[model samples]
Structure formats: C-alpha cells, structure tokens
Target: MTANERDNIRAAMDRLLAGIPLRSNGALTIVRLAEEADVKRHVLTHRHTDLKDEFYARIRAQGHVPDSGRRLRERLEQAEARLEALREENAELRAVNEGYARVVNLLTLENTELDKGDGARVVPLRRP
Candidate 1:
C-alpha cells in the first residue's frame, strides 16, 4: 500500500474503534468493526500491528484506550461498587432483624415468668 493509503486505512480504523459502544451486548469482538471498515479479519488480528498501535495512540491521546481489557476493567469497577452497596444494605437489614428477634425473645420470657404467678386465677369453664 502507498503511504497515503496506509494513512487512510489507519484513519478508518481509528474512526471505527472510536465509534464502538462502551457497553456491548455480549462478548467483545472486533470482527464486526473489521467488516464495517472493509478490512479483513486477519488484518484486525494477525496483521494489525501498525494499525493497532496507531489506533491505541490516538485514542490514548484522547485520554482513553479502547480495547476489551479496558472495557472489562470499567465493568469490574462498576460491579464492585454495586457489590459494596448491596453489602451495606444487607448489614442494615441484618441489624434490624436481630433487633426484632431480641424483642420477641424478651416478650416470650416475660410471658413465661407471668404464668408462674399464683395470683387469683380465672380459668374458663367449658359446658359439656
């Protein structure tokens, strides 16, 4: 390829990567992008050294690198944050449940102690 053609191809690749969504539906793969850019699958994989480097450099200049690893890291951070929030919620619920259980136990003990008192007992009579 001529110098200009190589530059154009690199530009196309940069544009394609930039357009990819941050959250994908499924596994992150580059076949669709390669097809869209009219580049072969092997070019995106086995023969992508020059274009991949240029693409990463350009995206990094924009303060981010575009790739599966970066996306996975971002997702992992989000998941960890969600897990932390859930753990806090669970702790709060457990504390509330413990308080309720203690109240129930105390009430039961009081009822049992009252039953032992021998004050005037009024038992209900059943008619046969």
Candidate 2:
C-alpha cells in the first residue's frame, strides 16, 4: 500500500478509536473503518489485514462494546423484566376473575333454589 494510503488509514483508525470520526460514522467495524479512511472496503479486508487485526485488538484490549450494541442489551433486559411483570399481573388478574366467577355461580344457584317453593300453601294472617 502507498504511504499516503497507510497514513490515511492510520489517521482514520485513530479518529474512530477516539470517538471522533470525520469521514464516516464512528462505528467499531471494518466497514466504517474503510469509509472513514476513504478506502475501498476490500482494501482493508484483503490488502491490510494486519491493520484490521490491530484495530480489533485495541478495541478488545479496551473492553469497549459498541454503543449501539450496549444499548440494545440494556433495552432487551428491560423488556424481559417488563414481560415478567406483565405475566405475573396477568396471572393475578386471572385468579381474581376465577374467584368472581365462582361467586357468581354460587349466587345463581342460590337464586334458583329460592325460586323453587317447598310445597307450602300461603296462609293469611288474621289481624287482631
């Protein structure tokens, strides 16, 4: 690779690692690196594999996860928690509904029993 190309790639790598990209979006990926360097994607993938490997090594050494990936993980955790809470609430509501249903059935049976007379004739009370 030409010295000018090497210089550009190194500068791009620095800018990306420092979270200050000028040419492309600051993503810790080879595609973004190529874009940042203004180089063809295949140049980095095929021509300068060492540079690419070094970039990944530095990222790994820093233990830096991409911002987007980290945020997605956090959101997934929150969604899972919310789902669990909803499931618990749904179960409680179902239990309450079942209790209400039982109460209504018991009341209906009582009403039916009351509607059936016990073969007793109505007696008129004599007023004194």
Query: Highest TM-score: which candidate?
Result: 2
Tell me the alpha-carbon RMSD of every candidate.
6.3, 5.7
Model 1 ranges off by over 4 Å: 1-8, 14-33, 65-88, 119-128
Evaluate all candidate structures by whole-model CA lDDT and list the values in order.
0.64, 0.90
| Per-residue lDDT of model 1, residues 1-128, tens digit only | 54654564555655555664323322224554455445666776666667656655665676654467787999999999999999999999999999999999998897777788765455799999
Q: lDDT winner among the candidates?
A: 2
Across 58-117, the per-residue lDDT of candidate 2 in tens digits comes to 888889998778999999999999999999999999999999999999998877776686
Find the 10 residues in a row with the least total lDDT in model 1.
Answer: 20-29
> Where in model 2 is the C-alpha error above 4 Å?
2-7, 111-128
lDDT, residue 101, candidate 1:
100
